[model samples]
Target: MTHPFPPLVEAYLADLDRALEGADPRERSETLAAVREHTREALALRGSDDDAVRHLLEELGPVDSIAAAAAAGTPAPTPASGPPLADTLLVVLSVVSLVLFIVPLFAVGTVVWAGTRLRAGAGDRSRQKTALVIGVVALVAFLAVLVSHYVATA
Candidate 1:
């Protein structure tokens, strides 16, 4: 189906609609309309460029997570006025660990912790995802370095 929104926004809304399958019809319709209206208003204010749309979707969070909340008859938490302190700390530590390469295991641990918090919906979703990505990249780089050292020594 054609939508007036940009492709990214259309795809996101489609995913959200799919995720809401099996939910109450009234709830599903209301949720979709609310989301569409919210998206339109945000785009009108922020501009509908790809980056802006992407950021909007991130703030909205994962489609499955939203659908799950709806199915449980719970309102999704509104975006926090500020990023949570724990989320900020974890993201900072993840970046520092990656840059320093001083504690590869600790970097991996922080990523895992961030993932758990993300799944439990305990912090800023976008920040948690960022931490996860940084940690994984750091772990992979650390492993590559170790492998190279072993090969060179042997």
Candidate 2:
């Protein structure tokens, strides 16, 4: 079995292929491709050593579980989609507010709106957090400018 992949990887793939038997043709191929791509990426990043390959296989989990998921018509979860549109919009608005720090009211409003939405668990956590951070920075900048102006006038 002198294949390009390590022996462990080869065995794992073989077992997965067998376990996937009776699965839909398209699903089976897609599953195989996803597994292969994952393996390739891991090997490239972690090296092809036995220990690394063994760990990678562990992370992939048992081939039986994967086959079971496929049989159940739930393709293995993959990072195929981006954040929701609302989340993206929040992030964009946050950035815009940060850039237009002169508009202190708008920046403060954006921060409050983003914070409220985040607390309600309305959208993706990461994007909401990003929006919050940017909004806070904008608020801080605006406050500093206001203080500096008052001090200079006085």
TM-scores of the models, in the order given: 0.49, 0.50
On a 0 to 100 scale, what is the lDDT of residue 152 in model 2?
A: 100
**lDDT for each residue of candidate 1 in 1-154, tens digit (9 for 90 to 100):** 5349999988999999999999998888888888888787666645677887888898888988888888888875555447668888989988887996656976878788888887766547788889889898888888889899999999
Clashing pairs in model 1, backbone N/Cα/C closer than 3 A: none
Distance from true location, Cα of 121 in model 2, Å: 1.4
lDDT, candidate 2, 1-154, per-residue tens: 3238998999999999999988998889989999999788666545688887887787788999999888888977543435568778888888888889988766777778778877765447778888889989999998899999999999
Question: What local distance difference test score does each model get?
Answer: 0.81, 0.81
Query: Model 2 residue 128 lDDT?
Result: 80
Clash pairs for candidate 2: none
Which candidate has the highest TM-score of all? 2
lDDT computed for candidate 2: 0.81
**Candidate 1 TM-score to native:** 0.49
Clashes of each: 0, 0
* CA shift of 49, model 1, Å: 0.7
